[model samples]
Target: MNNITKEITPLTQNDCFTIFSRVKKEFNFPLHFHEEYELNLILNAKGAKRIVGDNVEEIEDMELVLVGPNLSHVWLTHNCKSEEIREVTIQWHKDFLDEKMLKRNQLSFIRRMFDRSTKGILFPRETAQLVYKRLLVIDQMQGFDSVLELMSILHQLSTAKSMRVLSDATFNNDQVLNYHSRRIDKAFEYMNANFHKPVALKDLAKLVNMTEVSFSRFIKRRTGTTFIDSLNEIRLGHATRMLIETTHSIAEVSFNCGFNNISNFNRFFKKKKNCTPKEFRENFSGTRVFI
Candidate 1:
């Protein structure tokens, strides 16, 4: 991504956060990312296309999502026919809450939610409805009260049920690695670095000084996926970047990303993104405007 725009938001040093409320006919903003965590609520925008990292989906009438800092995201008008689309966006700097404060017992749920936001968290419609009232008037509050209100909103969202993560976990490069096991961490570190080449589970097991069957069980228990699937996820992450950043052919990108052939690449890409590589690239075309 060279084409993905980097948005320099209006949030200043003196502000805890910035809120933008607007009613528009359609979405026209380009795909972009910024150095601020964002909570966006959209109403009456059914059929609109939402792209968060490598995840693309059609939105419902009411939508709420929390996107982490520097994650590429955008909403396109697409098939939406609504003449009035209501949107409320709240953005805060990453450091707005101290790391120490986030670790406190009272803030445990919020802290976990923040960590999951790196992949973009999609709040359910029920939660969205419950909190939309507060979000609408939060900008009207003053000083410390406003800060407290924002924190309250986040805490509520953190405990909501059925919150889905929109993007692939590996799509964000800044995600922290904390499998909480030394062997698991080492295995993943090796997998990430060597994703462009052919990988074998036997080799990884040996590298981690464990037998193949034992290593497989350990990795699955810790990471919740098989070794081959994890390797493919890493390869797909790099492939998505190449698809967005380069003009290379699909077969070339597949090979360069360590997939043996185009069909396998297409299968994995569609399995993860619900679209072929070509379509994924085209989604980023035409309407992207940078300034």
Candidate 2:
């Protein structure tokens, strides 16, 4: 999918964060990413397809997620019958937390949460329901009160026990490695661009000026996965999206996602998603056009 870059500006003058609440009949946003950290809550959006980096899943009635800087994500209406979809979004700059402040004892949990969010973070439904009221009130608050409430909500989320990290390990690993080496960044860019075709370890190693043996170990150490596994994750991400958003047949989806055979695609997709392509598509109630 082609993802667009979105610019997020503060809602108020001199404010470091922005919060928005809207009720719409349809979700029309394109697949996109932004530089700011984003906290999004959706209500009455059951069966919506959520894409975060290399992760793709269908959401239930209510959903809450935190996406880190530049992580591609979007919620597309798939099987929602609700006439009204309520969404609340809060965005803040990554630099909002100063280095010294993040190291404080009291902020350790929040810091850890932020680190985990380099991939997308999905909070439990119960936790989302508990925080829903406060999120609704945030739009009505002003000045310091609004900021304080937002902080409190984040603190509560940081301490919540039931949460899952979306996106594949390789995606998060790329983010981490990019901070330490430019070579890794280039390697990731190449992989993302060419995942539909064959990728050779020898070529990647040459790009990084390492022997194939050394490159294999380097990939495993840096991404916590082998090169083949990372490639599969990227392909699966695309395949899953197509399964949910398009009317493609299983064979077509698999082929388009770079798998050479139907059987191999079925096996890998099942291993990753715990369901067959047909079953995954059947789970959706209906599809709606974006307004």
Candidate 3:
């Protein structure tokens, strides 16, 4: 959790990685990552973005980006002129294919594709358009033919020249794997429990009995973000859920999420999400609830 892989295992042992996803709304999720190789083709999107390991950017359609396992990222909508609809996102596990294909065979070029993933991958416009078209065709196929088409896609991805990695730090080491994880875990637990409502930095620092500055640095070193940022993440996380699944008004959501006024909530949401509250809600529903 906290965007890191605890262990490195053989590729063949891992499965259950989803190969594709489709969404019909503007996405409202936080910066979280899983232990899989994700190849996403965003057919439609308009938002602000945060790619934790390397960048914080603005993302729009049609985007083709590849996210490596455990790389923390988020693309929040600050404002949507209309509804947000995403077409296809293809995410494959690092071990989804064969071991020999990745470890020993240059015939597959899978390892090279993974190397490119270190920086995150973004396919150029025309290429993504082509990939999406082919993916649509493959979606209608079944059985072995489906697998063959997917493998063909991966093979093309392996040889693709229109790719770029999205982050700076390739290694996302799990805190649980660290010697100091117990302390880190306790601190994180406490932060999660009380991030909303008024959170005092000094009090949070004292929970682990450290000075504010020292604690802040300690947290940043462990999670690639400061303790305050972690707290805000909690609040923002809740806000995202409400925006997507509930019918709360923006001011109400703001107050419930621990922010004071409409302006502050707007500012914070925009900074973190890259889109206004109304836009986020519209991405999911036309329900006119508060953002």
Top lDDT model:
1
Give, for candidate 1, the lowest lDDT window spanning 10 residues: 282-291
lDDT (10s digit) by residue, model 3, range 1-291: 533322221111223323434455455565556556766666556664536466767766677777666666556665544365664545555556645667776544767777667567777776676678776556556556766677777677777775666676764645422224565667766755665567887876788788998877887887676766666666776676667656789888878877777797787677766578898677543221110
Residues 200-263 of candidate 2 have per-residue lDDT tens digits of: 8888899999999988887777766688876777677667667766888999888887888899
Give the TM-score of each candidate. 0.60, 0.58, 0.52
Between prediction 1 and prediction 3, which has the larger TM-score?
A: 1
In the predicted model 2, the residue pairs found to clash are: none
If the candidates were sorted by their lDDT against the true structure, best first, what order would they fall in? 1, 2, 3
Score candidate 1 by lDDT: 0.82
Cα RMSD to the true fold for all candidates: 11.8, 12.2, 10.5
Candidate 1 residue lDDT tens string, 91-166: 8878788789999999999999999998899999999999999998877787788889899999999999999999
Best by TM-score: 1
Clashes of 1: 0
Cα displacement (angstroms), candidate 2, residue 72, comes to: 0.5
Least lDDT summed over 10 consecutive residues: which range in candidate 2?
5-14
lDDT of 2 at 142: 67
Clashes of each: 0, 0, 17
